[model samples]
Target: MPKFIVSLQSNADYEAAKQDIEKQGGSIVDDSMKILGMITVQMSDQSASSLKSLNSGIISVEPDQEVTIQVA
Candidate 1:
């Protein structure tokens, strides 16, 4: 299985993104956020469609704050 590291801005983003990713067979291995408004999550997936969809809505997704997700 492949792994992905997705970063989200807020709790809502994390939750929504988590749900979406889970639908694509992503297993969240870990997650963390900082006071400066940064969230890091480790996930695993075999497809990219879910991530692509999630990213497409990121701008209007309304996370807690300005955040960045680095998919690894």
Candidate 2:
């Protein structure tokens, strides 16, 4: 189970992206844009790969990494 930040093109279709992601068992964690244009989601690596194959508007689907800082 990997989380991904799905970056999409400016002219992306929200409905199409939503449908594809949802169909692949991806859950909507946070949507960067108002609709499904830009979003952060929790999904399998397979799902991310699938999205890239089908969605032309997608810019990139990169794994979400956690960052921590030590304050002194």
Highest-scoring model, TM-score: 2
- Global Cα lDDT for candidate 2: 0.81
Q: lDDT of all the models against the reference?
A: 0.47, 0.81
lDDT at 47, model 2: 79
Off by over 4 Å in 2: 35-37, 67-72
So what's the TM-score on candidate 2? 0.76
The worst-scoring run of ten residues by lDDT in candidate 2 lies at 30-39
Per-residue lDDT for 4-58 in model 2, tens only? Answer: 9888888988768777788889998887664546788899888788888875587
Q: Name the lDDT value of residue 2 in candidate 2.
A: 85
* Root-mean-square deviation (CA) per prediction: 9.0, 3.0
Q: Model 1: residues >4 Å from true position, as ranges?
A: 9-12, 34-46, 55-72
